[model samples]
Target: MVVQNATENSIKIMKNLKLKIRKTILIVFVSFFSIFSTYAQFDGVFSHYMHNLSLVNPSYAGENNMIQASLFQRTQWIGMPGAPIMSVLSVDTPFKLLERQHGVGVQFLSDIFGVFNNQQVKLLYAYKYKLGKGHFSFATNIGMINVICNADSINISKLTTDDGYHSDNDPAIPIGKQTGVGFDLGFGLNYVSDTYSLGASLTHVNSPIISIGDKNEFNVLPLMQVNGAYRFPLDRDNGKYKINTNVLFLTDFAVWTSHLSSILEINEKYWAGVGYRYQDSFSIQFGLELFDGFRLGYNFDIPSNRLILNTFGSHEVFATYEFSLVRQKSNSTKSIRIL
Candidate 1:
């Protein structure tokens, strides 16, 4: 495909660009890690790669030409007290009406962080347009997010005895739980051809205002995820080998930023790969594509730097299923999922 060829050529250019941008990366990393350790924050990563249909790019919803459902679970820094537990369930499908291709998606997500919890329900809508024999799609998602904080997790003894709020019966901290509501908006663009695809997205547009406790003063930062991926087939047809690579950069308004991760995947019934996360993390992922286009994937993040000293590795699992309603000759995307 022309897109594939162009990207291959562009990689050489990008490699150079990466080097030239060293100062930005270094500054971002230093600013990020320094603030990461000092925060009592919500867990990120509830939406993993597969469930990322809309999270990755709004236009990516239903890119595979079928109604799809995906779910993901991630437990970060296992064995560590107060580790994060998160999950996301997503469904998306494509349809044609009046000669227009449209996609819709809905997601339910929940994340728990120490004493804090967040639940969100989102709706996504996308439209597809043809561009020089390829399909270009753009989409937007808007929904509501609810946050809950459990005061029971706080230790009264841990606080300094002060008349300001040291009393366990103090009204500011809220002895039980508190709740708040907010809204979110996200948008994405995707370009998909016969052999390759690329996408970009921006999430958390409204910057939800959630004040969990009476005394807590800080607000949560609106997060961002910028990612792109490419696939290279070794041959034009009947290819036994192919490489899928991707890069993801995540940042918050605060100093916490994850040094983007690079992922490489090999396609087959059973595949294995590894990823290196620059923010002191590493991951190895494996997957199996079973019958009826069902897929199961897993990844383990190896602790690095200071994190390794406090906890065991992190683990994640993903599952997805997609099938055609009618027995029509399927396209490349459908074929790959079936395998």
Candidate 2:
């Protein structure tokens, strides 16, 4: 009889535990979808796919055959006043020796809006792995984020009402600008098979609290990202004719709400794609590279929801160059040099 009673008690406890877990999950999901459903702080930052390669993941470093250098920029919520603008510069190189290959890389990132801006410098360490005929790598990154933020110059007139901005006369508002320090760590797994590749990464593990006084400690973020690309061969026997499409999906459960983009590249020289975002609006991008050495790109944003359109859709442009190239040898020894 005692054993029977104990069994009943155990079963009741298990049932209660299950109920609590379900409730917690439901509440979390609802909270996640609601908080970022409207205007968001970081929504404008991840509006384009190109920016992800340079700023979000260290695994993106030096995955290709040659040393790679890139620059990307984005202006969110085209036509919206006080929208955010972002820029990044990155360089990565692979080392090949003893039939094994690995790479190292670095990047610089800047994000600005209203009177605030954030700058980050990152270092990447990568380990190479072979897949079929091609090779790829998984990498880890560490960064120093120098947050040069100035809340004093916020230009309250431009911010208007209810977007989480307090009036200049508000007690919480400070009269002077302040600086903060933070750090970030990232891990990514990359793979390239045949003419296609895929990768996933988690970035910004150090989540710092940027607010004054530390009354409520808020960890800035930890993000999850997945990226993929495929290269297509065009025409018969046209060795130089090829097209590539790259897609990047991003989300930070805390802030973004929704951030995703798909970019299509036509041949090695040109690319164009469209993006959808809930925080601010939709974005379109176009880019071109000449002789695989000089690169240039542009993005256009159009406001989505109501009211924000009065400001204007934003425009951004970027330029990049590769100062050097690597040539692969065909294992030929020049006996003809004897002549």
TM-score of each: 0.77, 0.69
Cα deviation in Å at residue 327, candidate 2?
5.9
User: What is the TM-score (0 to 1) of candidate 1?
Assistant: 0.77
- Pairs clashing within candidate 2: 78-312, 78-313, 78-314, 79-311, 79-312, 79-313, 79-314, 80-312
Write model 1 residue lDDT over 1-339, tens digit each, in one string. 999999998997886665445534333433332232234232365224633546556677767678788888889888875567778898988888889999898988887766556788889889998898578888988988787767555554334233232455544444566677777787888777655566667777665566555654344455566665556666648656666565666666554444333334445556666666666578887777786678888888887679999888899998888866867574445432311
* Candidate 1 segments whose C-alpha is farther than 4 A from its true place: 1-43, 46-52, 153-165, 169-172, 213-218, 235-237, 256-267, 330-339
Model 2: lDDT equals 0.59
In model 1, state the lDDT of residue 35.
Answer: 32
lDDT of each: 0.65, 0.59
**lDDT tens per residue, model 2, 26-65:** 3442343233222122323444444335455566565554
Q: Indicate the residue-level lDDT of 198 in model 2.
A: 73
